[model samples]
Target: MTRKRQGQQGWGPEHPEQHYLVQPRTVAGGGDVRHVSEYLRASGWRDRSKRGGPLLVESPDRTLRVAYDPHGQPGGWTIHGKATGSTQEWSAHLGRQTPVEIVAGITDTLPLPRSAHAPNVWGPLADGGWHARFEGNSYSATSPDGTAWLQYRQEANGTALWWTGATDTRGNSWTGAFTPTTPLHVVQAFSAQLASPEPVMRPRGRVPHSSKIRTWSVSVTPSQLGAWQQARINAARAATWARNSRRTDRPSTSAPPYANAGSVRTRR
Candidate 1:
């Protein structure tokens, strides 16, 4: 169990190797926004982040605005993308607890071309044995253990949403949502991770676990954890090396729009 340092000297890549801790269901504590801030800087997003201010950046086109100011704003992230150049292009405000990996899933894919207009959002959750229910224009899904849920509504209902959330056995929950303008593929990326039965690793001291409930927990030998860590390190190095080889140095554009009011609340 070790602490993950912030900033991108070498501290990035989508998945950092998991440790002994489990990401608690009730509170959003384990993920780091730096995982994303660093990627944005590397992928060519202009690092306009001022010292002692919220981490900030913009796309080359200047349409997308991503800001990470965890303390100044407990919301954690504000992603704005105006591909359509409309007031409603797309925007998402992610809370402090939203897992950085899932956020990466959506943001990282933004620069890629979207040829497949329609993506299957439910398939991944279904594969994971999550149940789906649809009534009229509203659609939703929930995890088998009843610790997570996702919903998408077609009609504009004040604030647009693609809520993806998970709860721990104790009933605590953390949530992240994207707007309607956001790509389904992007939303799917978030959904797919939530649908995953894979355990989320954290530092052992920080995990929120009751004496007997550990459905999301897994035991790993030190040797196994070590090997897995080294492999991930190697992969990250290879990726960085390849990027350096092919490109000059510049990061790029990312995830998107809409804003009003939202929150992450634990279930009592």
Candidate 2:
């Protein structure tokens, strides 16, 4: 219908106001390594002689030498933690490919949530590895070919569909329909709007039957799209406001801002 521009407080289906903000990791070593002294003590050996002679003391047999690399060498980035339950044992390889390289003990690591810890659940493959969260129950759609159209999907079904731009050889934008089958579930129908050079989100929905299977429509300009987006956002905000207003609790105030500030109003 319309394209939404930045700066609007209200959000809509296509352009939800929600932003996925990640908490920044503050500490080095993936926030694991704590005290320098603690790390040194736990490491196999320290440069006690300070001559760079061997970090680890030689065993009587002289079979193995344990050394500590606080920072993984060459790259200089610290390797603090290891993955648990990995089928292939992960190791630090220097210039050579070795099974294990002596590393500083991983002091601590954070545990992932049980629900998402499994490999079955897909993680966001977007720009960065961002976890995708749908706001206001939105939908996304895609098609395999420009000539042939397919369905659209809601938030629940969004994960099932892949956003491969292959459908449009020129690699333009895609459009799809979100049809509500049940109160909780919806479906997607899709078509490509423009070529890869200039892309835009197009709208698709079930039209009254009798016409041909395909229909052609003109694309809206950026300015026109902006106005439409704002209109939809305003509508959604108004709806949310109305819904909340019905359940609002209006408290009666008896005193002015400065009068009897701590006292509660009592009705006789």
Alpha-carbon deviation at 150 in model 2, angstroms = 4.3
User: Which parts of model 1 have CA positions greater than 4 angstroms off?
Assistant: 1-18, 21-28, 72-74, 85-88, 115-117, 154-160, 168-172, 210-268
How much does candidate 2 score in TM-score? 0.19
What tens digits encode model 2's per-residue C-alpha lDDT throughout 1-268? 2335433634433432211111110000111111222223322223232364323322122322223343344321221222334222122212111111011111111110122232211211222232334435433222212222222234555543322122222222222221232111011101111111111122223211211122233333344445644543343344335435663321221221122212222211
* Model 2 CA RMSD to the hidden true structure, in angstroms: 25.5
Error of 2 at 144 (Å): 11
Which portions of model 2 miss their true places by more than 4 Å?
Answer: 1-166, 173-184, 188-226, 246-268
Please state every model's RMSD to the true fold in angstroms. 10.6, 25.5
